[model samples]
Each structure stands twice: as C-alpha cells, then as structure tokens.
Target: MKIFNTPSNSSTFTGFILLGFPCPREGQILLFVLFTVVYLLTLTGNGSIICAVHWDQRLHIPMYILLANFSFLEIWYVTSTVPNMLANFLSDTKVISFSGCFLQFYFFFSLGSTECFSLAVMAFDRYLAICRPLHYPTIMTRRLCTNLVINCWVLGFSWFLIPVVIISQMSFCGPRIIDHFLCDPAPLLTLTCKKAPVIELIFSVLCPLPVFMLFLFIVGSYALVLRAVLTVPSAAGRRKAFSTCGSHLTVVSLFYGSVIVMYGSPPSKNEAGKQKIVTLFYSVVTPLLNPVIYSLRNKDMKKSLKKLWGT
Candidate 1:
C-alpha cells in the first residue's frame, strides 16, 4: 500500500477533517436528538448501577464489585465515543486538530482497552466463583480487585501507546477527510503520506491478539463454569447456578461480538457501514445493555436497586 502524497515535504495540515454522521441536514438534527437521549440514558443507567452497588452492603461482594467496574467502564466507554460523535452531528464542520485527534484516539483506545481487560477479569471472577467455590473468598480479595482494576488501565494504555506514537510521526499533508465519526487508528492511517505497512501490520497484530486471548479466557472460564453447574444434581440448583453468570455472559457476547465483526476482518467500504453499526453496538448499545442485563437478570442487583430507590 503506497502512501500517496502529491505535495512537497513542507506541506502540513492544521487538522484532519472528520466527515462524521453522513446524513442529510434534517437527519443530523434527528441524530443529535437521538444520540443525546442515548447518552443521557447511558450516564443515568450506568451511574445508577454504580451507586446502587456502592450503597448496598450485601452487594459488596467480588461479583458486584466487578459489576460496578463494568458499570463505571460503560459510563466512560460510551462517553468517549458519543460526546465527540454528538458534537460532530450538531456542528457545521466536523474538524478536529491534530493534537485533538490524538487526544481523542488516546481516550477512546484507553477506555476500550479497559473494557476488554475488565471483561476478562470478570470472567476470571466468575470462574473462581463457580469452579473453586470454597476458596473464592480467599482468592479474590479486595486488594486483589483494586490491583486488577489498576492493571487494566495500565494494560489498556500501554497497548495503544505504540500505535499512537507511530501515528504521531506520520505526516498527513494530503486529503484530510476521515471516513468515520472519530479519530480511529485504521481510518486515520488511510490519510497518512508515509507508507505505513509496518504500522498496519503492527496494528493488525495488536488488535486481534489480546481479543483472541480474552476470547479464549472467557470460553475456558465459562466452559468450566458450565461443567460445574451441571454437576449440581438438583434442577433448581442448575437454574440458580445459571442466574449468577447469565448476565455476564450476555454482556460478554454483545461486546465481543461487535468487536470481532469490526476488527476481525480487513476493512472495506461495504464493511464500513456494518462496522459503524457494530461500533454503535459496542459503544452505545452495549453500555445500555449492561445495566439492563445486570438489573433484570440478577435478583440481587434488582433488590439492591429497589432498596436504593426506596421502591
């Protein structure tokens, strides 16, 4: 892939343009309203879950702590994507400065990485709960949970730092148009004047490897969990066993499903629209799904929420 550039080396760009929300003028207004409603709900729903989890002493176990982390992550995760997207939808020109673009990419990738790692941690938490029931309390201590959350942020940032640094070095003197709503790595790579095959390859590897590892961990954890659940002997015990993990599995499926669709294959024009749909899936829809799945699916969460709301 030859990085095309018609200008001399002195040519530089002030900012990269984002041709985000490619709908008509009337459509932009509708999208702004729609996204605003969704954003507010995301904040409220995820925020309520966090508050409920914190206030209820009975819900302060490792599972709810992980659920709180998921809720907190969902708040930032949707915030990272929707605010910029909403602004672009409402703005006349969807232009972001180079520094601004880099900053956006950093937060977007950081939050995304945190979500991935948090899901993996949640899976491990479930695995220990189901497979090693007697030792679960001793194994997942409060200090351990704090360390895991800290490690998630660290891992998420570290994973994206290399690609962001590489992108920073590349010059974008040509066309400034970006196809997507935000300053994502793959689409922004299309604008660079330098041949970034190496960068592309690096990103290809970076993108899928962690996801694959997480997929394996989730699968392995759930498999063991299912096997353990089946051995419970009593029919009611099996239903009770599934209730504990059903919500987590639903969230895991929604997030990883969107991710696999968006990044698993090579990028194309046809795929771009679908990718955007899946992008909304992971960003907007999944965050919305988190509280719904957790609250409706988990009896404990529902009771905690009821008490918190004085219902």
Candidate 2:
C-alpha cells in the first residue's frame, strides 16, 4: 500500500510523483513506442469518423450527428491522459504539478462523465427511431438534439466539481506519489493526511450515480428496441434493426464492462494491476476500436469513410 519512499507533511509537498508502471529501460521504450502508435491511431480513427459525419449529407441525421459529437469527445478524452502518460514514460522524475494533476483529474473524469451521458442519449435516439418511428422525426428535432448534447456536457463537467474542489483542499500528509497513471480519486484519497469520511462517502455515492443511471437508461431503451425488432414481420427488417444497434451495443458492453469492473467495485490490493489494465482498455483501446466497429458493420459509415478518402 505504501508506494512512497519519503513520507513528508502535506504542507511541504509541492507536487506529486506519479509512479506509473515500473519497468526496465527497454520495457519503457517498448511501451512508449506501443502507446504512441495507439494514441496516433486513436486520433486518426475518431477523426475520420468525425469527418465522415460532417461531409456526408446522407449522414446528417440525428444518429450520425450524435456519433460525430461523441467522436470529438473521444479525441479530447484520450488526449487528457495519454499525452501525459507518454511524457511520464520518457521522464525520469515523472512529477506532476499539483495544478496539473487536478486539471487532468477534472478533465478526464468530466469527459468520461460526458461519454456516459452521450451513450444514454444515443440509446434513447435508437429507441425513438425503432420503437416510435413515426414520432422520431417530429420529436428528435435538431434543436432538441443540440440541447441534449449541451446538457450532457454541462452536467458532466458539473457532476464532479464539488468533490474535486473539496479533495483539492484536503491536506496530504505523506509521500505525494500517485500509484496510477492518472490522478484518480482512490489513489489521491489514499494520499490525504487525514481521512475525511464525509468526502469519501460523497465520492462513493456520487461517483457511480451518473454511470449507473445512464447505464440503466441505456438498458431500458435497448430493451424496447429489442422488443420492437422482434415484432418485425420480415427477417431482413429484424436483421437491419439489430445491425443498427449492434455497434452501439458492442461499444456499450466494452465501455461499461471495464468501467464497472474498475469503479463499481471496491478497491483491493490485488486488483491494482488489473485496474491499470482495465483502465487502459476502456480509455485507450475502446476509442481505438469504436471507429472500426462502427465503420465495418455500418454500410453507410463505410461509404462515407470511402467518400472522405476519395477512394
């Protein structure tokens, strides 16, 4: 549990040393090369999706608009952590300023929260499109879609503000070394000088509410979509319906599955390595896979991508 070698008073601690995965020099170089490739691919993939959505008039529907926005969010979300992680890999000190740490903390969690809301919104869009096709065009207007996107961003950034501020103000008594790649709450909380049960309680309660609520809403929406799909008289109709949803469902499963394993459960000493792996999967791998999953399965997206490439 004690990862810090020098335990100092909170007043004397100026910044934190993020003790990212301890690896030999060769291993660090290997990892650096690997992650750099991953980061570039993440950008290229999500960026392509955004471009396809923007340029393709046929893709200017509610679903594609939401997807473009989600792709944009993914760009910043992975950027908030991966670049810094890459830097830490090269640097010997691996130190992050207090302000830098919290900024990463705020943006990373906020973007993640925004993604949760975005997925829920996408699911609701699907529900309307499938279960209530007649009302979908009338109900999911451009103005309404814009409002939903705005609300997702606003609510996501606001969700963790109070807790982050409170945590920032708390005293840190010892070695200010964070164990994970990012300034996650659990590791950061462990560094506090005095345990604030109230803050811990608040975090434990508030941390999962948005994720759980949004996840439940998505489940419900998809349930309705499934029912509707089953009622379709033609097999082709059923296949088309499932095709439209399959990518989102895959993404949802990958996202929520890793997240629930990471945040929904209590932290344990044995799970630290597992935690890092899961976090990397959701944060880095999932973004990388999203464009592939969407484009490969959706003919419209593939055509748009091809048009964007002038292929």
Candidate 3:
C-alpha cells in the first residue's frame, strides 16, 4: 500500500485523513483550547483518585482498591483518543497511519469494555457487601478483588481482537478519509473496498452484546442491593447504602446511556455530529465526573481528598 500523496492519483491507500469536525482556523483553535482544558482536568481528577486511594491507609479495602484500578483504566481510556484528537486540532494534514488508527480503535474500545466489566464487578462487590453482609469479607477478599480487576482488563482487551484483525485485513477503497474524530468501526467499514456483510454481522453481534449484558448484570446486582437495603432496620444504614450506590448508578447511567445511544445500532452514516457529541460525553466528560462523584458522595473519600490536598 502506498503510504503518502494524492488520493486521486494513487490506486492504493495506507493511511487515512481524519476530517475531524469541519471548522475554520479560529474554530479549531477554540476547540483545541476547550478540549485541552477538559483533557487536563480528566487526568487530574482521575489521577487524584488513584493517589488518594494509595496514600490513604483507610482506602486499602477492596472497594477503594477496585476504584483505584478503575481510575487507572479511565486514564488510559481517555488517553487512547483525547491526545490524538487534540493533536489533530493543531495539525494541518490530520493524517493517521493505518496501523495507528487500528491501535487507537483497539485500545479505546478495550478500555471501554474493561470499564463496563469493572462497573459490573463493583456492583457485585456492593451486592455482596449489602445483601450478604455476613459473608462479604470472606467472599470479597482483596485477593478476589485483584483477580476480578485482572479479569476485567484481560477480557476487555481480548473482546475486540478477532473483529479488529478481520476488519483490518479487508481492503480499503481509495479516498481514505474518515468523517469523524476517531477511528470508529462504522466509518472504517464505510471505507472498505466492497460490501462486508459477514464482517458487519460480526460487528452487529459483538459490538453491543457485552455492553448490554454487562449493563443488565449491573442492574440485576443493584436490584438485589436495593431489596437488601430496604430491609435494613436502621434509616442511617439505608441512607448510606443509597448514597454509595447512587454514585455508581450515576456513572453507569452517564457512560452506558451515551454508549447505548451512540453505538446502539452501529452508528448510521448520517449522525456524525450527534455521534461526536455523545462520544465526547462518554469518553471525555464521564471520566472527569467519576472522581467528583466518588469523592463528594462518600464521606471517607471526601476526608481522604481533603487530606490529600491538606485542606
């Protein structure tokens, strides 16, 4: 595949031009500044969580440990695309190597899958803590938490391997310009040299299934948790349970709701603007909010944050 030059003259393509959000030079500069601020905040917020969890001795429990790991994942998840997007805003060509695009596609989606699994595991932890309080310690040991974290990362990354490899192997027609910010599967498919019904079918199946299933698992876990919380005789216990669960539920709603709206049907070619907004919400905004949700909602986390900042 030819690596450079005019798409009109070349018969082969080895790179793609990402026409990210058509705008004037001034508009791109404005966007660059805005995204730069948001990206920095995301890193600070999530990085603070990991630091708080580590520096604070009280947070050595299974819940904080998992939260720390999830924060770590969020860091990479946003990094997989935001930096590149920010760079594209400043660059003239906005060119991405074929290998670079697929790598972004893989890491971005994998981290997202890992996040879904992490959320589900966190729900399970809460369920065990609430519904089976007597067995909670024995069941959700630190060892088990570590294993669950490992499994989430492993499974999340491995989920997209076959489809990405299969799709990357397919030939691409000329005029390799993707009409979005990142290398999303749908846009990539549109650039393929021929109709790929089988590949599309595989995407249709594999794309939303895990997200749907994991979301259902989270909801089911929360259902039992709610039942158990209601049965608690103490109102204080109930309030605490609701407060903790509420934060997780909010993050879940923000992340999954946008994801479901965006990739619910493999993203049609017409919704590019709306898709960018939703993707921006889940990918950039959600990570920034997660640390705020946890730290403010949980008393111990607030105390830890205060201590971390010496305020």
Candidate 4:
C-alpha cells in the first residue's frame, strides 16, 4: 500500500498553526487555570503513587508495580499536551513546528497505547486473582509480570514507528493551521496537501479493532470473576472478592469509555467538542482519579500508605 501520497511538488511546510478553542480572553484564562490545577494534581497524584510503591516493600506486589508503571506513563502522557496547551492558552498564536508536531504525537500515542495494553494486563491479573485463586501466585508470577510490563512499553513504541515515518514523507504546504490544542493525528492530517487516504485507512484499522477486542476480553474475564465471587459461601469471602476487583473495573470503565469514544471513531470536524471532553476524561481526569480509585477502595493500599507514611 502507498504510505503517503506523493506531493505534486516537494515543498517543506513552514509550520502548522493550531486553531484551538474559540473562546474569549476570559475563557482562555479560565481554561489555563483549570488545566493548570489538573496538571498539578496529575503530577502529585501519580508521583505519590510511584514513590509509595517504590519505598514501601509491603506494597511491592505485581498489581502495585503495574500501577507504578501506569503512574509514570500518566505523568508523561499529560505532559505531552498540557504544557503546550498552557502556552497556547496564554499566547495569541499556537503554531507548532513540523518536528515538534511529530514528537507530540509520538509521546501521546506511545504512552496512550502502553496504557491500553497495560489495562488489559491488569484485567488479566484480576482474572487470575479472582477466577483462579489457587493458581494466582504460580500463574501471575514476578517474571511474568515483568515481561508483561516490558511488552507494554515495547509494543507501544513499535506501533507508531511506521506511521510517523510515513507522515514524515508527506508534504505540508500553505494553510498550516491545526484545529485543537495539540498536534493530534486527525486535526493535523486535515492540513496536509498530500492525499492522506492511506494514513486514514491505517488509523481506521489500527484505532478501533484492538480496543474492541480488548473490551471483549475484559468483559469475558470479569464475567468469570463475578461467577467465582458468587460461589463464595461466606459473606466476608464475597466482600473480599468484590473489593479486589471493584477499583479496577471502575477505572477501566472511566478510561476505556472515554478513550474508545475519542480514537475509536473516524475523524470529523463536528466532533471537536466531544473530542475535547473525552480527551479530558482520559488524559487529565483519569490519571488524577486513579490513585484515589485504587487507594480509597483497596484495603491493602490503604494499609500500605498508612505504614509508608508512619501514620
């Protein structure tokens, strides 16, 4: 398949201007403050989770370790757009250079994709814990968890290499303006002079299919886990089972629901508002909520935090 349409004549794009939210000056300032607060919270929450997991030996289980990795990725994920977005909100113009744009997409997609696969791994972990309780330790061993984490990073990095290389070949001419706060794939592609049909097709195929499959796997795994929990004779046993899996499900619902909506559909100009809202849920809000979701609901995490802080 043709990676990118050949330019009628090769010309380097000077730069791309990002046409962000059409808000009044007051609205822009408000957005900056809102996002600034969110970014700070995201950093602190994820950073705290990472440090707690690292320093507390009692919290060194596979689940917390996975959470630590997710925390680190969340830091990078929010950083990719929030800083540039803050700058855009403060300035009159929001123009990003071609190299800068590509780099933004690289980090955004890389971290996002890793999180996608990481969620699946977490679901599988819960499945082993609840559905096959006796084999949880043997099956979800330390080596296996390490390998899964490594796979998430490697797969996320490799997934975008082809797409970025292909985008590099395409030429961007005049009207170098992008819609939205960041150099996202959909908004940026609309500005390209080259026929982006192949790029679109690649996105069309790569975007939704894996998410749908993973969604199905998560549903099936949880279904079995629920069945196992129901079989527990004692109320305490059932309560314990539910507590273990409840936070994971809550986070999965929040992150996956917003993410699937944003990337799972074809690009459209009209969906800009919807896109921004969903992006907020997945990118900014979810990270801030994750530690809270896990810590408040999980007894182990609460105990560990109490011990870690000597409270």
Best by TM-score: 2
* Residue 130 CA displacement from its true place in model 2, Å: 0.3
Candidate 1 residue pairs in clash (backbone atoms < 3 Å)? none
What are the per-residue Cα lDDT tens digits for candidate 2 across 1-311?
43232234334566889877889988888889999999999999999999999888999999999999999999999999999999999989899988888889899999999999999999999999999999989999999999999999999999988878888877676678887888888788888878888888889888989999999999999999999999999999999999999999999999999999987778777776877888889988999999999999999999999988899
Best by lDDT: 2
TM-scores of all candidate predictions against the true structure:
0.94, 0.95, 0.94, 0.90
Total clashes for model 2: 0
* Better structure of 2 and 4 per TM-score: 2
Off by over 4 Å in 1: 1-12, 265-269
lDDT of each: 0.84, 0.89, 0.88, 0.81
- Model 1, C-alpha of 112: deviation from truth (Å): 1.0
Ranking of all candidate structures by their lDDT, best first:
2, 3, 1, 4
lDDT (10s digit) by residue, model 3, range 34-64: 9899889889989989999999999999889
Worst 10 residues of 1 by lDDT: 1-10
Tens-digit per-residue lDDT, 1-311, candidate 4? 53333355645544677767778999999999998998998898788788888988877889889888888888998998889888888888677766777888788877887888888888899889888879889998899999999998998878877777767667666567776777777766676676678778887677556567777888888999889899999999999888888998999899888877776677777787777778767877898898889889988777776776689
**Rank order by TM-score, top first?**
2, 3, 1, 4
Clashes of each: 0, 0, 0, 0
Record all residue pairs in model 2 with backbone atoms less than 3 Å apart, i.e. clashing.
none
Deviation from native of the Cα of residue 247 in model 3, angstroms: 1.0
User: Every model's Cα RMSD, please?
Assistant: 3.3, 3.6, 2.6, 3.1
